[model samples]
Target: MSTPTTVALPTDMELVLKVFPMPKDSNNNGDIFGGWVMAQVDLAGAVLPARYTCGRMATVAVNEFIFKQPVQVGDLLSFYSKVTKIGRTSVQVLVEVFAERRVLGNQYVKVTEATLTYVAIDENGRPRPLPITELQPRRQY
Candidate 1:
């Protein structure tokens, strides 16, 4: 088996959480499943939406996703998220994943990165305008 890669995200990165991949989450090939990573990314991106919308929300689009390295069991995964844009009912978040190989301590490598768009929603799942915030900058677009 090939050794897992280590990942180090940017210093400016805002991490939501650090998680360890488990063996049960692996695919038949013994690598961590892609869907597992995707779920973590979704959760990471949703953190801001919950606070900004102050209510329900749903993922509308995965604008972009690129996996740079394979994730394996025992890798310590860190999810970092940042807001890139916000509209009337939609919020765009950029998420990056960094993984530290268990065997190779002190080394970190970026494993995946993505842009996700989520829409603020009502309890009924209908889109709703996000609550305006003084901290949020006004955008012409």
Candidate 2:
């Protein structure tokens, strides 16, 4: 098989999660199931927001999700994420999943890309403000 072309991985995004799928995770077509990949993306996308939320959080929405290529078992999957927006009680993040084939050393395929939004929640599950700003050293102090 001809090697797939690759683009340089994002430098600005954080490499939040790196995982590989097992045989049980494969779909009928033998590719890793879409739902399983989405679940991993959801977990990866939350890495950045967790720093700000500093409390319970919930995934409020998957604003956009696109599977550009199929993933197969044994392919090394790398999830990169960046925070796109930080609201008073919510954060929007962009996640990109790349598949690195063992045969194609140093090459990566853009398998999936998604945008997700998460909300910081209080003990009762109501929206809560991000605790990040409060952690900054006060100028008045």
Candidate 3:
């Protein structure tokens, strides 16, 4: 076995969402539930889809997810997302979660990352086509 090299995500990240986890969100073991973090990612990914799709959309799949670090109490979590790929009716977004430790001042670290796929939808909740946009390439992390 070998260690997987972690590549820093692109810096052209768009901050799509943010939220502070409260103490009540803790689990029995006192660690923040992974499910809560996932929900935040979903909400974060949905922001651009709702705008780009010009209507409602739904999460079709989670292509990849990795937890690079843990999130603890008093950490300020920020979710950054960007459109990585677009299709006729689907869009792929990469969401990165960074957490700022309470006692560490401005020091922050990447805590999680996930690739989310969403499908444009119409009022009836049926799949719809995506619109064209000037696609920009994100390079820095």
Candidate 4:
């Protein structure tokens, strides 16, 4: 048998989510659907942006998305995310999804990577400038 591929998880990014795909998430080819992956990416990608967006935000664009490998049922998926840009009223995030095989000694395989943009919104659903004061300074040791 060939050795399974493994990738080092990112230290700079945050572990936003971890999930296991069910059989229902798979397609005819026995791999999970791309839409399902995109939906998860959207959810995972919003994590870092939420800190800056505060009240509410909406996905405005998927700047880039690439599915590196097929995700099978029962694979443990970990979603890592980081903020790439924080604009006046929007935040761009990079989300990378890695899958671990339960039978393959939990070797990690990068399944997907996506860049998404989210715009802060008001109660009326209109775009609103991000609250700059919300980004408080971190304490220095």
- Each candidate's lDDT (Cα)? 0.83, 0.88, 0.79, 0.88
Off by over 4 Å in 1: 1-8, 133-141
Report the C-alpha lDDT of model 1 over 30-116, residue by residue, as the tens digit.
989999999999999998666688788899999999888888888888888888887889888899998887567657878889999
lDDT of 2 by residue, 6-52 (tens): 86789978889999899999999999999999999999999888878
Which candidate has the highest TM-score of all? 4
Tell me which residue pairs clash in candidate 4: none
lDDT of 4 at 105: 86
Ranking by lDDT: 2, 4, 1, 3
Ranking by TM-score: 4, 2, 1, 3
Identify the candidate with maximal lDDT.
Answer: 2
Write down the TM-score of every candidate.
0.86, 0.89, 0.83, 0.90
RMSD of 1: 5.0
TM-score of 4: 0.90
Q: Once superposed on the true structure, which residue ranges of model 4 sit more than 4 Å away at CA?
A: 1-4, 133-141
Candidate 1 lowest-lDDT run of ten: 132-141
State model 1's lDDT. Answer: 0.83
Error of 1 at 122 (Å): 1.3
* Total backbone collisions for each predicted model: 6, 0, 1, 0
Query: For residues 17-55, what per-residue lDDT tens digits would candidate 4 score against the true structure?
Result: 999999999999999999999999999998778878888
